[model samples]
Target: MAKDMLNAVKDRLWQWLSSDPGFILNHCERILFMNEYREIERQSSALEKMQLLLKIIIEKGDDSCQSFVDILRIHQAHYWQLQQFFKPNTQGSSSPTVVADGGSVVTAREMENIRAKSINMKIETVSGAGGSQCGNSTGQNPQADYIATGGSVICADKICNTSTDGDFNLSVTVKASTQVCPGLVDETLPSSQEPAVKMIRQHKEKLVDCLRSDCSFILQRAQVKELVTDRQYQNLKDISQSEQTVIDLIDRLMSNGQKSCTLFIEVLKEPEVLRTYPQLKDISWC
Candidate 1:
């Protein structure tokens, strides 16, 4: 069964790859759009492609095909390594002490001393106020800190915190590069809504500008087309009216034969006189 599956898979891949010269071209656009989702699409797509190759081997049913399968199997062992960055809640533990081979040791005190050495650490100005998710990092709570002053909020500050739970004393230095949470957004704080609302208003302004520009461009193009079409219609109408006038004049002259005969003789005599006077023939019609 596995052999059949592998053979089928390989055939499918070969077919897809060979089907169109432009198939790979379409994937370039997908790769660009995938950037918005923070590269998750890229990782998942790679895994799927690898799995398809495995299916191809099972369908082949030959001992020689096992070589490719074995190679893939080896590569699969490092799946966790590739997936580590995308894994959630894998941030390093805040606990000071971890259990060693024989006994438990305190690392929390040591970490605090590390924080006390201002000479070693750099100062940064954090923008946001309270506890919330940082831009690319899972967020830590600001109020949970014990110290709230000087842009340095110690995680031990929250009222709910207990002593030496190891979760406490996770001090954060609000550096200039740090992504700040706007504030604590609870029922009690009216100020929490300000930043969110302001952001919405800004977005609305941008949308309005884009829409206006698009409308202006469309209106200008439409006006030009309308002007050209209107001019063409008026010109055609004028030409048709002038042709009708000529037809009417011709019909009148034909109906009145005597009058038409007199006018034709007069016109013929005038051209003959002009021919006799060479200077008159060359003169302006007006």
Candidate 2:
């Protein structure tokens, strides 16, 4: 029964992570830009929830789930650092403000604060799992070792003895950052004025071909094949959609009378777009 409960929690977390397109896009943008502390905090909260679920799974889940837990651990480590980056610098100031360190500029006390907050928080567990639904154990914090050494906290044996009944609610509640459209140039450049048109044209075709190849490869995968039998049709549709998105972005940049190939490459590398079609990473736009 415990094993089944853990599996259900794992499945729900996986579904939440995979099904939210906007969340994934936002997450990618946060990782790429490293700005927006609010978004980082939102993501950090979600990661904390997942970390709790993972701990539960490790304690009672099947051996197969171990590999998935290991992968999640890597993500947890990454977000841990990000959480520290965005952690409020309240040690010296009366007003709470996020620490926007562009580089490695954190103090030792700040690091300790991050570690404490991560380990000391209480994560509400999935209810009706036939066990205690809180994370506190023996009225003693189970995070002393982790806090001292700055190591990963072990939550397997720490079970909270409280009762709460509800579905596992891990949704992040934060307003998304405002979206700004790229400025379009009023005057169009003549063919003679654009020196890299030929190069761009060739690069565009190469990108489209790569997108089609990636679509084909995705359709051929065993997991995808089981869900969709019309592989050829799906592959074509995916390829067309990816190609159009890339072409549209490039066209917008070029229409702005932008001459720099490097700028065009950077726009294409935006996290929102790149998260959807990672195959473009292989292209040498320069």
Candidate 3:
């Protein structure tokens, strides 16, 4: 039963982590805080604790959990070495430490630092080599080198061999292909909106007024009811029941043959309505 409960909790935690990648950091922080404060009891089994610690380390994707990882590695290796024919060194030294196999004596912290330094050295070496190669390649392309030095490449280029500085003279000419007339461009521009958008934009004010009036009427009626004693309060049910009335008001206000139903639906989906009605927060417009 205990193992089943642990598995269930682990499954739920994994599901939450998979749903939101950003939640892992918060989850790890919460777990660490709980462990520190003893808000939750620790696992009895070392293997269970190690499993949880490994999961947290994988989620963290950083060196913050290196100590715990090192501890687990040391325990696993020592366990295996004890069963082998050639056992590892377990003799205590005068300096209060014992050397493991291969005659190396280093603490987990020192090993971690050494690994970090080696990684940094490798990265720096690769970056320096790449930079030198890029520099040489760019130097071979005169046009690219000129652009890299803040010179713009435009239009036609004529290369002239000169005897002075052993450098070729590059002549570039830039010219506009056509003049732009504002009036002609404006007349030629295609309209982005369809006929429905144009109709909505033209009659937006009338639609807004109609909606406001319908809401006021619904509020007045709702206020008159004995159950609704508060005149200022309105709930989601009130708005839902009066939806048809608001739609009818919009239809009456809008011009005929303008696909006004879609326009009204769009108006209802506006940000202003959502802000005004907090109860409609969960409504899916799509």
Over 92-196, each residue of candidate 3 has an lDDT whose tens digit, in order, gives: 422222222111112221112121111211111111121212322211222111121111122222223313333322333323324332233333211113355
List TM-scores for all candidates, in order.
Answer: 0.15, 0.20, 0.18
Stretches of model 2 off by over 4 angstroms after superposition:
1-5, 11-61, 79-264, 267-286
Model 1, 88-195: lDDT tens per residue? 352364632221111111122323322222222222345443332323221221221121232332322113322342233343344443433443334222211334
lDDT of 2 by residue, 150-193 (tens): 11122222224333343422222222223222231323334324
lDDT of 2 at 149: 12
Sort by lDDT, top down from the best: 2, 3, 1
Error of 3 at 250 (Å): 13
Once model 3 is optimally superposed onto the true structure by TM-score, how far is the C-alpha of residue 125 displaced, in angstroms? Answer: 43
Model 3 scores worst on lDDT over the 10 consecutive residues at: 117-126
Best by TM-score: 2
What is candidate 2's CA lDDT for residue 23?
A: 30
Ranked by TM-score, the better of candidates 1 and 2 is 2
lDDT of each: 0.31, 0.36, 0.33
Model 3's TM-score against the true structure: 0.18
Worst 10 residues of 1 by lDDT: 97-106
